[model samples]
Target chain A: MQPTSFENMFKDAFENFEAEVNPQIWVQVQQQIPTTAVTPQASVTFSGVKTLLIAGVTAIAAITAAVVYKSEPKLNTLVESKDNPVDNKVEKTVAPVQSIEKVLPELIKENETQKVQPAPAPASTTVLKLPETTNESSANNDNQASEPLNTVTNQTKIKESEPVVEVINQDDKHENNLSSIQNTEAEKTKETEEIKDFNWGRISNTFTPNADGKNDVFKIHLPDANYFKATILNINGKILHEWEGENGFWDGKDAGGYDLPKGMYVYYIIATDTNGNTHKTKGSISILK
Target chain B: MDEQQLVTNCLKGDKTAQKQFYEMFARKMMGVCLRYSNDLATAEDYLQESFIKVFGKLSQYQFKGSLEGWVKRIVVNVVLDELRKNRILFDSNAEVTDVLQTTDDVVSNMEAKQLLQIIQRLPTGYRTVFNLYAIEGYQHNEIANMLQISESTSKSQYQKAKIQIQKTLKAQTII
Candidate 1:
């Protein structure tokens, strides 16, 4: 039989089959259809949702207001001190050290002398001045004590040299100040080196290797002697390709059946050393069509 | 009222047309809901939710295609949204790995109802693809786009569903 003839015959049979089924039962099935109520309780629930949304918004606004109120004073102080040149100069020199000290109490406490030495040591050394009264008192005392004297006479000379001893104590205080300054400079240098190391670890280098004469594939130069697992993900955060093998390279095609679209994609690299230390780096790459 | 007049009157919020419209589409859409839902009660709830959403968003519907198709799409979307909210349909731990290879000899002899029953018994990932691709007449690309999966994943899931259905049918006969 032809396809249309067969289809027409099937339709007739199906209608006859439907007619054989009870029309009352079908009507009863239709009558049993479920109804949803938008009652007063549902309205109350909706109002509650509205209240919650309003409360959430109010909370966000209050938090924002609190942050702004907290930061306003510091901002005003900065703006007010912007005009006074001498005061500004002094503040510029001293404020950073004070702020640094305030921010990092442990660092300040750990290297107290280092904090003092870096800024003031050179200035103090250049402006060195000795008190003259103590020098004159010492000379006079030495002249008075001619020969080997009795204990009482020696005591008398020492008493006369009191001013000289005070001068010596003042000199010793200056020397201590210099030592503290040297300590602070050393600590600062050590901290700077640490910061440099941290920055070095964070540095990410990318090279494109598109098989064009120009940079084709994106090459990541991990810091010397760091092993990493590199993963390339599409815009939807789906991992298109992953490389866990010793050689950290991804040709950009997924393990599935198709090539990825040419667009901006994110790559994540997680490096772990034998020492159980881990570092993560993420960046984007562009694929040319 | 006829379907078109019912739709137009329902769009105007006429209670009679609204009731008639619900009566007309509820059963077929309930079947759609039942296929996606975990149970009959949940299916009924989904159907209610879908109708409410359809009524609310009726103004956005452009009359470019069959109204039935548009309504069916809305119902399917509501089911998907419910699945997402319940967290059972797309559990993160459910990973689709290698496709299962099964002999077609068993699948060829299976009836449509038997095939559908087996499809229903498959995992959520496989069942969704089987329903969308095989029954709903969606392409792999469209399924991928709608489900937010790769096209390859959609194909693989359909293949896995077929293999699973074949195996289940074979096992049932043995029993």
Candidate 2:
């Protein structure tokens, strides 16, 4: 046969032909060859992962702090006062330190020189209660009757840190108990006083809401009215504002918007002392704008 | 399944697809190995080695051309590789027969099975060159490169294989 005929026949016969393949051949192939499953490469760097974790942690901490600030906003009230002019006015008008009991402390300081005791122990927070007197009738009352106040300093620490503090407003029943224990429990401690006499202390006769760091509030001086509910009503008896405490005072506002107009507003105080004694007294505060 | 899918499945280490892949090409690849090998056992060894290499290098095979063609090339390389390792052909340096110029009558005269038997009977040198140039259609230069021989040597071995096949056919009285 010619070489050309031979090559053609060879290609035709065997190109697609299959011989018997041993089944065991595949087993040998499988044993020798590794599986081609996916192999992971080292892709992510360590610092990249660390940055992600740090970012996540910072986000969580910020969210938690925001939640805390929102829930207990009063905790930031001190800090916010400096930034907010409106809040500055509000604070001057209603800084808790201006207790209705503390009269013009500068005048009290001046009076103390003449009234100093021979003990020379200095002016103190010790006193029988001052008589209750509102700013309207304050002209009739002796504004300088009491000695200078020596606040058992930081007494407000007992509850809210106000210079004038009524930690827990009690009735007259607790008054005797309070006086007997006053030296032992009331000092380095905040406690109540008597409800026997309905008296007024040095009342600030004018509430100048000028935010001038002066008398921007009406200090209603119902000193014996522990456990009291008091409302400031208009001349029409329209209740403008209401406040209560063992001894509480009010901001010159209606508790919401602008300050009350410069005029007389009623201060109606109904006091229930620890002794269950209830006293109702109506007075007025003149807002001198 | 298409050749590309079959290769992909095999690459994924799916044992069933691997088995199926073997099933699809095993017989044909064995035919190629058998021509290059001395016996059924040796041919089976080459078949296994070829398949292992086929799976190992599957990822390197870009699926642009025929997948079967790619696999067939791997099987052929495995045969040549085994021959080179044993080195029986180079050791013998057997004489080249004067059968290069003969007609194709002898190879054509035999049955396909008989032709395969006679081809396997040729010496390793002649047999591999014949399988590459004749059945596999590789040029003499390619065969020379594959067998690590000169182009003349590849031609000589192929001619000698033809003479051996012709003699076997004459004895069997096929031509």
Candidate 3:
């Protein structure tokens, strides 16, 4: 039998062993950090017409709430942004939107801005006129943020359409201490403008394709997209499978239904939401079995 | 900053602190991953999965034991999970009482890379058992519990792994 020294020899040799980690692994790890940490996850219920309206409205409301919370002290932006006539329609449809505005006056002093523009008059006709004295003060206060807001506002209006336009219009004028508000609004509007902001939920990085009913398929979450085309490729860049529409998934099998050997595969997705905006994303998925 | 401070910052989702912590443990943990995986790619996958888990569960690390030990435990568990998921860990009731003929000098003489390659070359079941028992310093019962195999199966796998490693060492010496 081997002496006890044999075991010690192995342990001693490896106890402090260090191998060079591939720099790419860290890059992949960075991407897989839960999105919930940066973007607060808000699950809201809605009974609706088509999936388009539901997801669009949900994304606008949910991301609005998320962006509001993200900047914490910028609670005034939500109330001021929601003060418009169109947003009044959103508040009637979304309970969370209604609740979020109620807590604003108690949380911050910026509610004075909302008091200055409480006109329930249709904002659709009021377009482009800065809130009288607000534009200069806000522009002077946050030059950097307002610069981007100026550039993106037109594009956001064209792509996302309706609902968010008036918010941008008012926010552009009321930029005093509103850097985070403009930033969140710009960010949320940009996100929503992309593919109707179809909340793809979380895309799991790994799945077991052994058919045990738990994550047996590597599903790309496309909750409300009207059209989607994806190709699953091997590391060698050979296309293994291709499918269309939101029901598309890679079951760890080739087109012939043969179980692919367990390893990492790349997925490229191009999808069009109901608003006809196309989004393209590339990522890797691991087949556990 | 010190380890405790680093952990606190990482928990706060500080990107710089997270990168710092990853740099501190990644190499040693990569070494651990290499021992359990069959190739560099698989090992890299294991490393990525382990670090993601470590960061995700960093809140649960109660600061009781050595941080290295806690991190290594999570690394090993991640490897075991991948192995189990792949279904390569087979149960064997057959006993292997044959004495390991390889001497300690062989291990000492071999480069750590050579030893690691030899370990990686072993059958998945044998290599896994050897890793858990001889290298990771776990008892056969603990290995069995972790692998979902019986105690006897764990003992036999370890014994067979030792014999296989000894034979490989002997062959290399002769060559």
Candidate 4:
């Protein structure tokens, strides 16, 4: 007989071995096995995915709606009414007169102008012209009128002589009022323009006091010469040391006069300008000892 | 099924595949747990807990390295949790200078089991380092992370464990 093939013999022997050994171990494994079924968490995961999809769809729909809404034309009737010719003409004619009337007392209170030429022109013209109207008797009244006319001519000559003084005072007052308004508006614009330029750039907080000359001191070089206070904090958020003055220098020492260990620290700087406006910057520093 | 297919099926929540995976790795993981645990029952408990954790966190496994390594890490973490619960104290000295001198005669005479027994008799610190470095082929830096000790301390503890085991074996032979 031919010798049994190693593969067949091995397979038979392995099957017998498994048959003999598997039952006991399997039984023990079953007995120790937890009674609870390992419930599939797929439903929970699917619900989570469903919620996320719904949220994403809602967000996308909201954004699309907002975009479409903004792109659509929306005309305001109130704005259109203000631009209409009838309204514009009425406002243009009335606003200046009302504004002038409102500002007159304030201008007078400020003593910015002198009340001279034409101060009571309309009232005096009406008062003085009444007698000329009532003297309707013909040539018989003319001689009497001529005598009054000579007195009127004398009064006109007196008024003509005072007109130059009145005109000079009125011109000076008008120029002063114009300059005061222009100066106030110019000052306001300058303040707004200055505020736009007040941004401080990147600042370095890391400082090494190892005397190696790499990063020796924590320096906050302000963009401008301003009063500043800097405080150093440890990892526990305790204010370890603080320096308040013009100098932006902080030595790497705690409040208790001890060198802090090598680790991360925080530095906060509060800078105040001459106008009393304050800006704050905070950052972290890594110290290597 | 091939190992990858089995792993894929396990990830798909195929209970049969998961059971096969548990059977394949549980014994070896139990051995790992036994080394870290105080006794057999605690070792068994840690083994079961580690398997549950391993299954729960299976999604995080990126298949970058050996699956066995991932399972072993879970087992070790489970054992460490038990150790932590027992409030085992760890020395925090940064500078550890302890050195153990081991003779060639001690190594030639002592079996691995004898050495293991002596190590198990050691304090938690020395045994952890010895098992991680000597038996598990871990570098001191890796051992440092596992035990939260400085690298130098890990090296020193391993050397101290070797010396203590050698002395014990030497004493046994003389007796």
Question: For all the candidates, what are their Cα RMSDs to the real structure?
Answer: 28.3, 49.2, 17.1, 31.9
Q: What TM-scores do the predictions have?
A: 0.37, 0.44, 0.50, 0.38
Candidate 1 residue-wise lDDT, B1-175, digit = tens: 5566766776665667766776666766766665553333345555666776677666677777887778889988877775554343332332456544443555445444344455545566777766677656678898889887777777777766666665666677688
Evaluated at residue A50, the lDDT of candidate 2 is: 31
Give the alpha carbon lDDT tens digit for every residue of A105-200 in model 3: 343234334334544533332332333333432233233334445334323323323333445344334333234444543442233455345555
Best by DockQ: 3
Which structure among the candidates has the greatest TM-score?
A: 3
Task: Rank all candidate structures by their lDDT, best first, as comma-separated numbers.
Answer: 3, 2, 4, 1
Could you give the DockQ of candidate 1? Answer: 0.03
Q: After superposing candidate 3, which stretches have Cα over 4 Å from the reference?
A: A1-3, A35-289
Candidate 4 Cα deviation (angstroms), residue A275 = 77
Model 1 Cα displacement at B38 (Å)?
Answer: 4.0
Q: Rank the candidates by TM-score, best first.
A: 3, 2, 4, 1
Using lDDT as the measure, the top candidate is: 3
* Listed models, DockQ each: 0.03, 0.24, 0.34, 0.02
lDDT of each: 0.50, 0.57, 0.66, 0.52
lDDT of 2 by residue, A1-289 (tens): 1246676788877877789876666665776555464543312322332343346643333323322222122222222222233233323323443442163455334323323322222122111111122121122112322222111111221123331232222222233343454343322121133323556455554578788978766655556645666677666544566666634566678745567788888776666545434454566788887
The local distance difference test score of model 3 is: 0.66
Please give the ranking of all candidate structures by DockQ, highest first, separated by commas.
3, 2, 1, 4
